[model samples]
Target: MLNFKQPQLRDVIEAPADIAQVRTNLARLYQQKRQLLTDKAHWAHNDAALFEAGASYTRLFMDKMWEAFNEDKLIGDSALIEHLWLQVVQQEHGTAVNVNYADEAGENHVLFAIDQALHVQAHLTAHELPVLADITDEAPDYLINEKMFPALLQIIKLLYAADLRFRSPKETILQPVNDLHFGVKFPDAKTFTATLKVSNNVAVPVKINVEIGHYDVRSFQVVDETGNDVTTIGKPHVSASGTFSWEAQHLPELTNQTLTLTVEAVAIDTLPCLDNLFVIASGNNILMRTGEQVGSFQLELPNKQELGITVNSQDETLTLHYPDADTQIYELAKTYSFFGEWLEATLKTAIIV
Candidate 1:
């Protein structure tokens, strides 16, 4: 999800009572709009009396609601209110409405500019009362005009949108991370490195937690590109279950750079032996022995690299050759029953670096 700061405005409706009233009015207007849209078929069939009655009711209701909004001063400053109203109207109605005013110096000043995300850039200027007068005079006609129902709906939606911006609870957003693969030798510990880039748009700093599965994390550290210890930026803690969590403050927003996470973890080695089938690993090689001879076994690496197994039918020994090493001979004592048991044990015991 994209993260960006929400637009800010002054004297926004903040009081609980004012917000409650605004919400009530918004709901009423929404219901009215829904009814109007629902009766579109009847209106289109030239039900003149029905259309006139609906239009009159909507106009009177909206005019009374607008008067109430002004009397309650839900949003202080007439110019600011008009600016927000026109901005939303323009956006939702797909038509730009003139919300700007010319100053004494003959310079046109925008009351507010709304972008695609409804982000507002507001500028206080003169001639606000005239703009408000224009809106008030033309609003009743707009409400009665059947073609302008969407604009009326936008007015209601804008009120709720602004209310949410000011009164809604803050939320912390987190992006999902891809799956991680850790490679470690059996009965041995290996350190693996993963990189994460943090992008935050909220005002407060956030704590990040990375979870690792199927391994026990021994140590974890965070470093910058220059190998400087930036872990002091936050208190880093590693749970016994292999979760590394840390909070960083005042980190620079990056478009491309990323922080490095170095973790030292050991693979779990409690794989149970079944039916004389046993998996043994020494150095960088894992050897599986079976009582019956098998032609071959296919092994897949965490990196999607496939490893070919070399079978020694004489001893019923299957050897997995790592790409980084040559095939080595191992002396086997007991043979296993099937390759499936060995494969399961190898998967459980294997860790990618």
Candidate 2:
């Protein structure tokens, strides 16, 4: 019951012309196979030609093993047989079943493709004799089993490791090629609104893969006037737009306290310059400072690390010094002067570019 339209076995034939030298080889193969079938003691099936002299060299194996499928046959289709065959010889994966025949120790009747390949390969290697007679076979996974498989695997692993390539366990599946840009509009004191701009350069769906909180700065330090250090004050929350936030209330005594922030960014073999960051606040008086010196600070748009912030003082302008940098004072001219007499700043922000 096979469909010719869908692909069915019209022929099964494989033979090696050189193997014709052994008169008993093919004859014995057939003779023993027939006797085994007749014996029925170990016979798996009747009328199945385990050794077919008339079939082609490789087809002889299929002729014996084909068509006895239980529900859900492991073999995809008869079409797969093409991989096992050339004009006269079968290829690597489809050459033979790996099952070991009873002639060997701990062997079974099931002729798995790999087992058969190994058997044939070993037989050919040991003696100056050819079982198939017509073809020579040697390649990867040809016959991997008990005896030589471990050694073969060891050799392959050594070669693979030597290739100088590393496989990461935690990295995302694929890198995001599309640009990740966002715009932020702080509408009120309690909320921050942002817009995510993404592109469809990748075929797969895009999700936020890079999160700033996951990256840790080993040397991050925050010291309050009470001498309390809270470096791990909740990593800055990251949105699709790359905006990050650090909750000061979560840092124990950091809310109404004076503090200094120092940070360093390090990669495997390289280190970035350690930049000291500080934030001093009392009541409503806020003083934010950064860098080694003030004057050296460049007014680079979009690249400004410490943007303008609100602070108390008649000057209205927040003074941020770069202590680690050359002596420099960056006067943020756009100071939001408050109406109250004493210094008072509720929420501070930079001018939207």
Candidate 3:
């Protein structure tokens, strides 16, 4: 109902009444022109002052819009004005305004717009704009119940997924070297000692994690240089497959520490059957035979002399001995074969000093 239209003049003034009407219209027009001029002068002065004061005029305009919207004096759609305010913020600052939904449906568009509007509201709140902040504090009940609640829930879930995928720890602090190997005489239980070394180059103390990959571990213990049982400080986890793993609570900085693993295990008879032997033979250049094929397989010694093979069967196992050392017992189907050459080559290749 607030009108700013200029009064119009009639061309033909027929009588004295027409003259009175003309005077009234002229007075009203004059008052309207004065008001416009005053407003223009006030705007020019304020604009210059604001520029000198280094104030953001766009934010000031947004605050005024919020005021007008609250007072029911705004002439246009409130939602459109809200969208424009957010767009202005997006242009001024680099904050992301829109969330791209996979489905571009009508509801999704509404949600996107609401997201942008809320971000602008948050921006106003962050900058401590008192007018908008106080007005927004009493948000319409419909907006809270219908619009913001669902959107906030979805945003929280998205943030949690992003945090877990990108921010969680992917690997342990200490990278373990592949150095767990045990040498044992066949048909006998032997205790072997191996050292695991880790270097800590950082300034602060770090926890050390030791992982042993070998599966024959019957009993395992970790000790430090002064023969202190370091595994007592941290929990040791052993898998069903006998993989020994431990994590220590403390390791000093810029130090190279060696942790000794004392493992007791039985050998020879504990070695797995043909499937594992095939894997071992495939890498060692040793040929295998099963099911009724028996022949003398000769192997050239490291001294370049050919050693003759004598296969003796006992308890479905073939035992072949070299001059001094007994070879590893290789389990086959219904028979076990011992290869002195393979054992000699494996002892040279497998054992880590």
Candidate 4:
């Protein structure tokens, strides 16, 4: 009998429809992603916004992949993953990605390596996106569907945590040693650079921490042994006081190299001395200015608001004063002189040696 049984109705009908549905879903997804990307094109000048837009596009793309792909197969095709990642990098101008996870409000957040983010922005501004491929991650290029995506998410989480630290404004302070001495370079009233050298005489290696006080300052840097920078450790914290601990190995011996940092002071609280007379403060240091003649004073602040100063201006003489918390009046200087016993003594102690 050469005759064959007829095909089952379920198999003949369901399979073609399922394949068509998958193709339809993918096509719709591709179109929606293209539209989202078109909207993102306008956000080139803004980082956070551009990142958000790119994140939305990534979520759409990933959702389509999940819907169209078989869970038992490799997650994303290598060529397709690279193509999409590169597309996002070129269109959004960075390596930021959305891993399709929701936050407390059920919002998808964008993830990025901040160093890469900064580099991408620089390259985009310079019109040179081609060179960025060398630095970007191809991890997604290796991920397998369902089986490897979880691991990939975990890896991205680590990168996210690191990026948070990298972008934070908190200074890292490692093992504190009393043997450290700072050479401060004062450029102006509120600007200074400090070089810290630790004594190598210690029998054991000591760790040191870096502290960043004012976040509104111009900039900061931490240089390493080979003249390379390790300032990523000095990101500013939201609070006025934050610290980061460093391993002993991270710190170079004092004889080999010293730690250097630059800080620009922003005036926070000011105390009026007299008419046109005021004391401006940057961190714990105060600058008392009397008509172009300025004297620097160090006021150790347990809290910024606890300290107060008053100036009593008199004819042919000006007096610099500070009132302690107990309301006792202390004269900082009685007279203005280019070189006076009181002024010289105060400067010698007030200025960082």
- Lowest lDDT sum, 10 consecutive residues, model 3, at 168-177
Candidate 2 vs candidate 3: the TM-score winner is: 3
TM-score of each: 0.22, 0.17, 0.20, 0.20
Cα RMSDs, all models = 29.2, 28.1, 31.2, 24.6
TM-score of 1: 0.22
Question: Candidate 4: what lDDT?
Answer: 0.32
In model 3, where do residues sit more than 4 Å from their true spots?
Answer: 1-187, 201-215, 237-243, 253-255, 268-353
Which residue segments of model 1 deviate by more than 4 Å?
A: 1-20, 42-102, 105-108, 113-353
Q: State the lDDT of candidate 2 residue by residue for 1-353, as single tens digits.
A: 12223221222222222222222243334454456566765454432343232133334333332322111133323222212221212343223333233323443332222212212231111111111111112322222232432222222122223221112101110111111111122211122222222233333322212222312222344555565765465454334343333334332323334455443321211101111112112222443332232212222222243332222111222322322221111111112111111111211122211
Question: How far does residue 110 in candidate 3 sit from its true spot (Å)?
Answer: 91
Winner on lDDT between 2 and 3 is 3
Q: What is the lDDT of residue 216 in candidate 3?
A: 39
| lDDT per residue as tens, model 3, 32-148 | 543554577664455444232222322322333333333332323333333223322243322223322222232322223111121222221111111111223253322223232
RMSD of 1: 29.2
Instruction: Please tell me which predicted candidate would have the highest TM-score against the true structure.
Output: 1
Cα lDDT of candidate 1 equals: 0.37
Off by over 4 Å in 2: 1-154, 157-219, 236-244, 248-255, 266-353
Model 4: residues with Cα > 4 Å off, grouped in runs: 1-192, 201-219, 224-256, 264-353
